[model samples]
Target: MLPLLVLVTLASIAALYVRGDLNPILCDGPCGPQYVTPPEGLATQSPDPDEAAAVGSGPIDGRELAAAVAGPLRSEALGGRTSLVAVDARDGKVLVDEGDGAQIPASTTKLLTAVAVLDAWGPDARFTTSVVRDGGRLVLVGGGDPYLTDAKSKGSSVERADLATLAAATAKKAGRGPVTLGYDVSLFEGPEVSPAWEDGYVGSVVAPVSPLWIDRGRVGAGRSTDPAADAARRFAELLRARGVEVTGEPTETRASGATIATVRSAPLSRIVEQFLADSDNEVAEVLLRQAALKAGQPGSFAGGAKVVSQVLSEAGVDTAGLVINDGSGLSRKNRISARTLAEAMAEVSSTPRLGSILSGLPVGGFSGTLENRYVRSGQARGLVRAKTGTLTGVHALSGLVTLSGGRPVAFALMSDDTKDVNPFVTQAALDRVVAAMADCACGA
Candidate 1:
């Protein structure tokens, strides 16, 4: 009898899967939500190179959109913490709903951090991981440069070749005798993984998020029981064994405003672009700290949060239902609502700094976190640009979606404190919502 019951349940689940009720729908067809049809003036493809950009940047009505998105979102199984906000970046429209404010941002907090950093430090700024000749000892001082890698690309955490090259360059520059090489990581003041960051989360490579490292924040390629700092030590030691001589202890440095050798990143704008597109936590954290520093505060989580609050207040965005634990949104304690995010999105979109934020967004059906998402949904495929967030019980996508009439719509949807709901499901729901917007001729 028990076996039969199990079979029945399995059969029902299968039936739901077949009926498109069990999983979130992605593409437009009989399987997914209806395709959103552009109203009139909106371009279905990329804007023509010769086209003049439109600017009016009216305020977005986030409250209305929030109501629509939240009604269905919260009705689902979230982990009692959820946030969603959508802002029509082009026109400064807010379409959002109110939910838990201080929910953990996870990687989503990276967006805020990235933008603030760009604003604080011009895009051309480069972080320096210096190779200094301190008497008989050669020290590789870390300037918190996140992109010192052997690979000629962003997000490639492996910097063996690059480190090797730098070491070789240093050796060649020295031109004689063995010089002791020391790895200095004194720029950052604490552990790579924050006390607020979960240990298990920090342990993984995906979160391979570290305090500071050269190669775009990649951990050494292996499994280890050591903490993040330990990994840094091992990496440094590996460099040493690789023919880079060392005499002094391999330790984290605490030097500031000191220059040895500088390795510039691919512009702050580029970093932010990749960050939003890839949803990189390490880049986000660095950017956040940089922002704090820019805002005349310590470049730390707490400092960044304070800066964010100040920015929001100055920008006249309502922070009634907002709590930021960390800029990366990795914290489960970070809370935000669709309304707040929408407001922010709208304002940022209208500002001259829109490029930093918009350029970073993952193009729907193309790159970044949304690379594999919304591929089949024709209306949302190339038409939607957004950021995606996911945690154990949370799934969110927020950004801009351009529709007909050259009108852009912003939307954020988040689900937290839920049971057994995957990101795919939430993505399906979001796709449907975007499709609905696409098909609507609201402005037309």
Candidate 2:
């Protein structure tokens, strides 16, 4: 018995010697060792994809990439007004900078619009454009109709909440076979773009945002009617063609106290995701209105812009010189610095549900407005992920990208004018800067 006890003591000592050391878990705030108890049915679950990829991986070497980019991305090539800034989102470190302090976020300003909407309206909150019966007249109240169509191609198309569904629901809900449908566009103004917006830029590729339409009156050349109303009428005609009796002509009005039916929106997150992914001006405007409405404010651009500004200030983003003329960055007067954009990007990156606001951006050679713009070098091909902005003389890109060092980085580049320089040339230079960050390991 004594011998066995002695042997046990020796084994215990050997086991203690075998235990080596543990690395410290970095934390800026109060943190304790987490004791994770396996939940039922999750014992075999794998780690999250991002976490797993990061485990035990060393930082990537990006010196070559940075040097390569810095080589051709000449300051002289870009208009003097051009500015660029890149940051590592994972560590909040600046990866690259060229006049990052200068404020001029063109369409990239929509990112702020997206963040405001998401904060005001949680990810799953949806927009609703309603069709209701008021006494004998059918009242279609516009709840700032972001998605009010049968065109599945558009960001705001509502298949289940469209005219047919409204008609069907109206028929079933009222116990009456049919009702006179009255349209109300009073929910939003004719367009989200202010009357003060530059006249020459109107009716261009990206037009003003109006609540009651789709395509901003660019459905065809020189078109300027309400796209939503047109769609609703077409839908009504379709219903008539399908044997649903129509009694009154569709008329446009504002939202009223009478509401009979509503086409609800998908949650705010999904809608924001779609809008940010494509920089959909109409979606941005509608979302801004929806945010204002949700926040108990008037659903107008001014009200929404105020709320948006408040949201930014609350998020610790500096909004000193920021001017948001419209939800989309189509306005020339809209100004935001690269630093502000980078700051907003960083904050949103830290938020839980924003999901690859970085990943959603247009990669140099891959997607969105940049798809055809930057396809030259292999480094620039897939390394950059950013939002692209363009007006007569303005071009910009802002968002986040993963550096070769495996650090997620936030970046913004703005070009006011090329001075007779081709826009493509400026875009290529921006792509090179992004590629440099992707290739360099900045110890982030």
TM-score for each candidate, following the candidate numbering: 0.73, 0.76
Pick the TM-score winner: 2
RMSD of 2: 13.6
Each candidate's clash count: 44, 21
TM-score, cand. 1 vs. native: 0.73
Tens digits of per-residue lDDT for model 1, 309-396: 7777777777775677666788777776666566666676777664667766877776677777667645567777777777776777
Question: Which 10 consecutive residues of model 1 have the lowest summed lDDT?
Answer: 26-35
* CA deviation > 4 Å runs, candidate 1: 1-104, 151-161, 205-211, 220-245, 253-260
Candidate 1: residue 307 lDDT (0-100) = 84
